[model samples]
Target: MTDETRTSALQILRTLVGSPTADFHEGQYEAISSLVDGHSRALVVQRTGWGKSAVYFVATLLLRQRGGGPTVLVSPLLALMRDQISAAERAGVRAVAINSTNAHEWGDVVAALERDEVDVLLVSPERLNNPTFREQQLPALVARMGLLVVDEAHCISDWGHDFRPDYRRLRDLIAQMPSGVPVLATTATANSRVVADIAEQLGGAEVVTIRGPLARASLRLGVLRLPDSKTRLGWLLSHLGDLPGSGIIYTLTVSAAEDTARLLRDAGHAVRAYTGQTDTGEREESEGMLKRNEVKALVATSALGMGFDKPDLGFVVHLGAPSSPVAYYQQVGRAGRATENADVLLLPGTEDRDIWQYFATASMPDQARAERILSALERERPTSTPALEALVDIRRTPLELLLKVLDVDGAVRRVQGGWVATGEPWTYDAERYSRIAAERVAEQQHMIEYETTTSCRMEFLQRTLDDETAAPCGRCDNCAGAWYPTAIAADAAASAASSLDRVGVAIEPRAQWPTGADRLGLPVKGRIAAAERPLEGRALARLTDLGWGGTLRELFAPGSPDAPASAALIAACVRVLAGWGWKERPAAIVTMPSRRHPQLIESVAAGLSQAGRLPHLGSLEYLKGGPEGEPGGNSAYRLAGVWGRIGVPDALADDLAGLAATKPDSPILLIDDLVDSRWTITVASRALRQSGAAGVLPFALAVVR
Candidate 1:
């Protein structure tokens, strides 16, 4: 607005970019002015690498110069926080973060904030509700806060692709902030509905929304539909090196990422797997390696999606299509940020829809489960998550997520001991949730349309983001006719097939009983007795594997008949058993009773017994059928459901009892079609060992992690 203010902002911008000619982008100047000069709430929806961080950094500097307190920045991911901290330092702004990784340094960070030394403080949304931090440190910071920034703010709206419950807590923070404190929410991918929702949550009608064009002219987008996983891997193995520079290869599942990365590395290419299961330290290392171009690519999942910054990334290849066009746009935006030309390709799989449905269902809260949780909390004192899991029928992961949603909705509060009911009237909005679910299904269909569309791929993505300026880019394969090669070499295809077809997954035994199991009337307590537990088991493949996952899904789908194991799957199971490397070879194979797939289990056991030259001692039959309901729930409930259901038949008892006399310490190989909670195997093995069997070793066709 004023000459002096412009000059100061421009001076800081130069330092931020390390260039004397650096200036704000299209909407950066407006956002900065609104936050600094106007002291107003603003929401900026711009494409990635469009200087969103610059607006906040410049505004924070200006506010600090005016003797304001430290700016509190709520960033979603640790990777993003790391990048923002580095950028802030480049501009001579004192920046630090209080996250899970840097717990040892929190006291020093708090001291700096107390002394007014921190120019900007970046924190994860989960930290906002930390008991000690919220009650002690956060209040002081909020009282003197100059500005509040929400990075990846699309997460605040449930309609966004990556909805996070922790992010919704920021609404209370915004409401509690001192009056006149400017708040800025920034995101690269937000449709009109999501943008409106975020603005409403921020300041309701008064929130200033500045949306820019969502087109990325530098990207050459394309879609290549391969027949199967092997062909897709073949195409990647053949053409990945041809891309401009080091970039990312995203997969829909962690197993796919790891398998792809392993295949690439084995072929003398530098690559690594980055996923949610990756260790924190290793994830940081992988990020640095990718940023420095030390590796050609990081095969990843959505874990590396938002807030990862690499300006010159040359390509982004999706091994499987994302569920929504908006999500695809966000991930592909990582490429061509600071390059003249970058390649983007989508390899959509038939199995993508199934994965989409699994994740989408996981995101929606179950009304009945929510009501159960609330009712349980109402009658009790503060209850810990472990204790609650034994009482409720939900698993730990979904239970914790549901608790967060309930906490933010004011139906519950997390206290020092645990969670307690707030007695607030909370209604289950089934209508809104159903609408969101329907919207998700629509997005999945839209993704299918994106793959099939012959029009400009860039235009399709831009339109998905609700950009009114959507048009042909004249660069995508659909517009320009296939810039990427589709040919796959014979040798490469063979190698990929071999790599993908290889299958064997270790099934770790359930070493300890879940907490509070005793309260559920089960004698099991902390550590499961070693003698009663089944030895470390082996599975032919994971149910979520990139190779065998599809076949297993079809076999396990509801209403699917009980059929014998296929020749190829049985052969794979034999290979898994061959590579088992157990301390003692089993003298007999015992199958578990499967109400749904009895033929499948017996077929697998008979095949393995014939191959290994071991006796097929028949299956453990259920006294009164198997467990009620489907497999899944807390450990105590699952164990209770399975206990006493399976037992060794009298016909097999004589042979099992003779194992001690014939082959002193030989193990009995307990075979099953699948393993979910491992409780059935645990109970069955316990029954066998109690019947004079020396030991029990479990083997399964597939493992559900």
Candidate 2:
């Protein structure tokens, strides 16, 4: 390249970095040169905050100055896109994004693109598959694209810690690009395997990989093996304030994040909960709040993991170990990016394994379930997700996820009517998927070793990333010997115990009946009738709640013996009742027969009846056998499993009639050991309403969310 062009690129880099003093990192210039001068595909694997953005931004400016088309950046998260847009604007690069959250602005963005006003066009990976966008906007962008930049590129590879199926569509996008259009894929978390896989996907023989050292000298990592959840909560409550600056608290589940945020807030910390359940607006606000140091921390799940740029983040504390060391490295890398000496701590829990196992298979498509769904979706008529659920035995969550995988794989097509089976033949690669699952198991074990290892934590994480330059830094608890507190104050422990012991989660009634229930011979569809629906119910706690969750999990775990409700659980249930804000109190109690935990349900019913001065009007009887519904699965299948299995027994009907005669419009409380899918309660309540009950209010020991 000519020195004049190099000087111009450096000028753009200076503007992008916001400081004339700032210069390119080790391989930043090389990557930028490759994309601009050579116009070659490059893969840059460097540490977080290593200015991956600068390389693209500078290259985009230089290329645009040379009369090239706008750079098309395929970002993974909306949050990341927002950050990139802001950074690009600061560099005087006109950038705009087209994502789910900004449909209203698409026209303006398109106009800007047509006017050649946009230097960088940011889009999510999922946007590539959008029918309207793909059919129209995307093809134009691809044809005129100057540079195709894939951020968090490891997501394209199944071997990566956080593999996203949507990212796999990038291969097609890359192939569609003009030969001379330079493509750059960047990530901080890929190991050799993931790197190789991503490079192969990018372009087998043409990809240029630029890797750098992964060690972070500013990060001081450590792990605390708390005996249990309560103790771990206590430790966090006590020491969260002691951390260096405003930062994040990572949790394994949404409930944990919420619970921890609430407890920490009650203790006078300004914190907020962030999870996949959090709305996009709130997530954006929370990210801004964290960036500006308006909140102490965002107690978040992996939803807040990638593309969140906060350079001065003080610390990152994990309530439970992440499933993979590579993932842990990515999260903890969020801290100490531009700062010196940031704290990173992990409070490993026994429950971590269970949580890990739950998520490990989240993306692994089930072969039988996939086949069933494909077979159910006739080619002639496209089937809506709900209708398909009714036709297939798969649950809604996994089923929807599987459909996306299938849609990306070309096995199915989502059209106006819904999803329809494509004529293309698809075979589930059982061996590859099984091997990936096994790799995940190994990764989980590697995380365990990360927590327990008596060596430099940073070095261990670096090694996990396959960084050749990984070596011990004179930091971390292992090297420095206990840089954090080991004790939880008595008052803090008491506060944490109180927070965790508190239980009660509102159970929302199913507003709409599962679609195609009529086709299943049940004659139910669309919105459930208000008269037949159970009132907004209450459960002692959600099965996912940090408080009472562990105990309930133990009680409901497979092979757990059915037993009477314990005094503590009964008290907790009573507390849930006391807090219940029903207009009219229940005058009678009817237990839902538990085929698995009859004694437990009976004991809870008996206790509530005795304590609340309500009549115990016998249990609802199963006519032939219990409802076919098991604990888990999609709503339609679960409803089908339990449909017509439960009925109001004669004695219960007689008692209800007599009670109605005495006190008309009296509500009857239905007790059950657990509520999952809520179909059992729905079907049972409909039966009671048909049998002349004024109102049915369902209560359960736990709600399986």
Candidate 3:
């Protein structure tokens, strides 16, 4: 049986790679043999480009040839699914994918499955929870599945760097599989903890764990400490061209990615920004461009991580270090997959910790908020997320995440309409959460150590991942004495400085009232009235911007003193106004009464008014100490908190009326210290417009993205 399987697998492997001499890597054949011959569950923790996909594809065709059922592959990303399907086709296996993007083709896929034409079926973890697919298809698939494959399986472990709530549902799926059905889970990023967790979840002591050394022989690792974002950009400007081939330049935030991409393009480099905010079609196009080496590099955030297969990628450069060394290893593993040499460089920034903290907390479920969500859904009927938001204080993103966690915990169940409490009596695992948090802190410290370590960088990363065979590679900067250039060209430094100095971000006005406002007992609904809407406004910078973000973060940090704007900030605000390109100058300036930063808001209004030579019309009256709630709530709740809480004073009303009579086309500039929900600005603008202002132009010092 083993010899026959080997011959068959080698044939498929050669066909898959288009090479007659192609054969299995050291552990690939073992993984396949365990599944096909032993019919046992297996976990393959290998580096990227190790042909983990090949194990499953080869096993799948062999199983089907023996009259077994098709393989069900749970993949993570659309790009990955596309690549897998193409590879399966090369091996003469019919593959189909069911994901959000290709819902229209799901019926065709189902038809093909029924006809026994599909040898492999790929679906995302989220698809396992889809109402129709879960109820209508999963049970039947589980009954007949020849081999169950979980790609990027580290996501199933909470301790993993990129854990997904949806992936935890795999435990239920695994439990439901028919007895003797072989299972295979594969990942390129998993430390010892993650591997143990995944192995236990896959099937406990019966599972065969296969792990290889986590080191890339072709990767030359290095770290270059840069003082600020401008200097980092200068280094890239000076040295990007000198790197190998088309690669990735990773940033910590969306704004930074876009900013870096723009700067690189301005410097005549062929590059584009890829982030979560990028359109789906454009993301596909960008991936294609990068794979074909049509561009020099892609400026991207972590959204570009995992399942992006680019053999011979040449290099991977981090504009800011990731929070954990494991994550760094996973990202850098993307390079040198099938090449003799690839460059992996890290440019650690001062703001990296802040960014890491923000993301780390964003993923953890808050105990209080989770309890509130459960309490809101304890009623008899199913409640949609928006309706639940009206009843609870949590924002949409976090609220949805909490719901998924509860769903996985068996405390809540999603139905056709929305979600319902399962009455399963769930308890928050505070101890476990605390331990995970502590582990995260330790991992962050390890990442810092990795940046400053005098020891071998590659070996340090391997040890962080708990690779037993970790040893010095004699290749990284620390071991080989800086294989990368460190000098920044004078012209490149000037260009980077100029790019950072350029400021002004447009604040798009909120055009529509958030849905479920009526549930919150708010009168407003549907599109905001055109006349009441504020004109497109301007901000000095986004709170996430690579340039001004650090200063703004410090200024608005909790417990920070609320003082008047600094001379430099005031000047930056003036620069924003000068470059605004408004249709007409403002007739007067109106300030939003601030609860925390009254002095700051007033000073910015005064400074801009003085600079523009416009009359300062005083501040709007706060009916109830300004808006009720704090920052970071959903739009409906945020608007509800602000509605009827701001009023146009009689004096300011008369002043605006007088200005409207004299300068009918001119708008009243409304200034605020910060904009988060934008509901405050919308409400304030409506009040000013109702009080006889020709129009309102909203302005803010910074925007919280």
Candidate 4:
């Protein structure tokens, strides 16, 4: 790095360390500050407690003080925005967060900006696309913008920690701003590829990387090699502090999160769980307990707890092996932040690799399956599951599995009534994700290799990242324990060899549904109130009468941190009805407007779709993930959006006309699931003729909207 760039990077961290709000350790400050310099746009690639947020917040304040036009911070989460703004305000910097929460209060922010009275402004990404904000307000105000900071910049790069195609547009928006308005992007983890992608999108901005030694000297790292999830859970309880400080247990699934939390509570921990499914209060309470040391541990999925800070957190233990090393590092880094002597534990089981493989591969639809979906859509018609079953020639088992992949990708939606296409068909672009996700997955594989190797685990990580240490990292379990280099060395070698011999991860095996599962495909026609009910039986029966007509799988919700699991079961049943081609409907979708910020909607959509299900988290997953303007999964947001806008047969007919008027290429009517709604086809056909979406064909299966 040039001396000037090196100095500039150093100064950013130094400035934060020197701030009245903080006096971080010299080395820690250096490590964090080192990220600031010449990288016009960079993802920080560290964990929550690594002081990454401080690095950027300080940058904002500094830029503002230097007469930088008010800095614009697009936070991925409302909580993160509030936290940063609160911290900035405490440090005597004027910052305000504008969101749907205080819809009317925005006048003050506008007044302050007009008066040049504010130093920083924080907003969720959706706020940027707001029709009024985009056309009328921001153009004039941001014209004088000094700096643009995207807190979770990963959202912008398809390769970064998170992938959001819509996020890719930020680069274009930022580049259009007046020349002097610099952009700073930061994340906890981004490999060389993700960094490169971000830079490429950022008008060819240069990247300045600050990856220091991997070893946390004062923190102890331990690995528990167990045989299965059950045994691992037992081990976690044994290690439980039996104290108030919060610890988190990482699980692979939302259902797992619920199950684990129940197990812990039954074991007498007064514990709670958070996933993409828990209620807002539940999530908030779980976190609150952690911050207040009211609960000793929390069970959650991999994506939870970004931008959450709890100094003096005693430990972070993973009940599962995360898919990648970057994820592991981020998860474990949660501990040892407020003090030395904190611990991080990872409980590895036999199927750990299998689980990782499931996420990576299951996420990518098989080529043949993708092709089938495309062919069906090209014909401008929605096919039933049975129809798809014939086309793909797979046993019902594998066909069901492929269906989930399509559902997650927004290619299809399901409901109590049937299923239909919300948008275009599935198109695989290996260049879009495989390379980046592989690199991310490989990093985790490398960690497994390193841990299994005879050499010290800490030493391996440190030596790889910082490149100076050949000596052992005496602090790790391997370095101090009996499993050191002897037999482990041989095993790790074999593991690496086997890893190289295999093909990349593939889709997960299908989960078994009930024998008499009544189902449908998208293009649902029903009342939104169907999903709003809490009774599974009523929901199912109502959906069936509306149009649903397929055998559904066993409905099982292990816990109810949100509503009774019964309510969730009904929602699931209704979705089955919608996804199976019940009818084209929208009113049957928006039972209620979004009660949370925007970000949660994103996470819910992405999380559900990732699981090979549709993104209709409804009240259950919505409260669990957070609201709009909160950081969430891309898959979830899209699903919720489609589901939210769904209407009845009449409404679907109207929207069909509306969309046709918009003239979507090869326009087709969307349905969640399908039943035999008489009005659906006739009304849809009339609407298509009226508005003119070329080759208009309504699509759905086990009907959902």
Candidates in order, TM-scores: namely 0.98, 0.97, 0.98, 0.57
Which prediction has more favorable lDDT, 1 or 3?
Answer: 3
lDDT of 1 by residue, 1-705 (tens): 788999999999999999999878888888999999899999999999898999999999999999888899999888889999999999999999999999999999999988889999999988998778899898989999999999989889875523578898999999999899999999998999889899998988889999999999889999999999999999988888898899999999988899899999988889999999999999999999999999999999988988788999999999999989878988999998999988999999878988898889887888999999998995348998988998898899899989988988889988888899999999988888888888888888889999999899989988888899999999999888999899998988998989977878887888898787787788878887888888888887777887787788889887999989889988988888888899999999888877779889888888888899999988888866667546866788888888778888888998887878999899999988888888888889899988878889898888886
Task: Please list the residue runs of candidate 3 whose C-alpha ends up more than 4 Å from where it truly belongs after superposition.
Answer: 160-163, 378-380
Ranked by lDDT, top first: 3, 1, 2, 4
Q: Per-residue lDDT of 163-182 in model 3, one digit per residue for the tens? A: 57899999899999889999
**Rank order (by TM-score, best first):** 1, 3, 2, 4
Clashes of 4: 146
**Of the candidates shown, which would achieve the greatest lDDT relative to the real structure?**
3
Give the range of the ten consecutive residues with the poorest summed lDDT in model 2: 157-166
Candidate 2's residue-wise lDDT over 1-705, tens digit each?
689988888888888877887778999989988999999999999999898999999999999999999999999888888889999988999999998888999999999999999999998887888778888888898889999999999889885423567898888888898889999999998999899999999898899999999998999888989888889999988888888889999999999999999999999999999999999889989999999999999999999988899999999999999888878988998998998879999999888898888777666788998999888988878888878888887787778788888888899987776888897999998887888898888888899889888888888888888898999988899998999999999999999999999878888888898876777788788898988989989998877888799899989998999999899889889999999999889889998887789889888988898889888988888866777745667777788778888898888888888988988878899998888888889999999988889899999889877
Q: Which stretches of candidate 1 lie over 4 Å from their true place?
A: 160-162, 378-380
lDDT of 4 by residue, 175-267 (tens): 679764556666655555555666676666354444434566656666767654445555555546442256777776664566567666765
Q: Candidate 2, overall lDDT?
A: 0.88
What TM-score number comes out for model 1? 0.98
- Candidate 4, run of 10 with poorest lDDT: 545-554
Name the TM-score of candidate 2: 0.97
